[model samples]
Target: MGVLSAEGVLLRRSATDKDDALVQCAEALVALGAVGDDYLTAMRERESQISTFLGEGVAIPHGTHAALGGIRRAAIAFLQFPEGVDWDGQDVRVCIPIASRTDEHVDILSALATTLSDPAAAAALREAEDVDAVLALMAP
Candidate 1:
């Protein structure tokens, strides 16, 4: 299965802070049976250790090495906050939460980095009218 899915996409979500964004995306993965409830905590811990902000209003949040037990599979959850989130010092509008168990993390991160590196793609994501548009951006 692919890392992204309809159930994992969120558009114009309202998150007060980083923890809120983490919870929203983690819950999406949990709903898809990709991760356990502890995934949220693990994601938060990872964020605390290192900033996930990738610039261009995007942040890819994932669990720490110790939190691997919480991941049931390799999956990704997308969250869009039109209002933007204060990710450390960067204003992040797109949040891609990842739950991975294999070496796929590198591949996924690389792909995401490539996509987010494009100014048009990043802008399209921020202005996306629906989930399908976001999915198109994530499509390989």
Candidate 2:
């Protein structure tokens, strides 16, 4: 197993629910930058062709290594759309954006699965009104 834990993952309270998935994913990409140089732009470029929706009112937007400016680290973000974002077949109110260029990415995904797989966490996130409240759900 990898070192995927809820510590680095987060649940967020987005200001607006009408945000475009592309935009939300891009912003998350910036925060998880490894190359650290214009990572947002690179993320958009990577996202131009694909939708990273993971089903269940959630979307996982991914950026390739080229767009990441190189290096590998998993960045996780929890986005709660007040209304919801149109994604593929379903409307997503919750999104988890993750980017990684190394094996650590696996750990991130593992952590994500472990955390989100919990019914309590998902329920809490849906009900949480603010980032602080969301973070509490992940608290030990």
Best by lDDT: 1
Deviation in angstroms for 122 in model 1? 1.0
For residue 99, give model 1's deviation from the true position in Å.
0.3
Residue lDDT tens for model 1, 31-121? 8899988888888888889998888898888889998876788888888999998888789899888888887657656766777788987
Minimum summed lDDT over a 10-residue window in model 2 is located at 1-10
Give Cα distance to truth, residue 35, candidate 2, Å. Answer: 5.4
By TM-score, who's the top model here?
Answer: 1
In order of appearance, the predictions have TM-scores of: 0.91, 0.62
lDDT of each: 0.84, 0.56
Q: After superposition, how far is residue 36 of candidate 2 from its true place, in Å?
A: 4.8
Q: How well is each residue in 26-122 modelled by candidate 2, as lDDT tens digits?
A: 5655555533545555556655666666655667665666664453465666667756766655677676666566555565455456656887766
Model 2 residue runs over 4 Å out of place are: 1-19, 31-50, 71-73, 115-120, 130-140
Itemize residue pairs with steric clashes in candidate 1: none
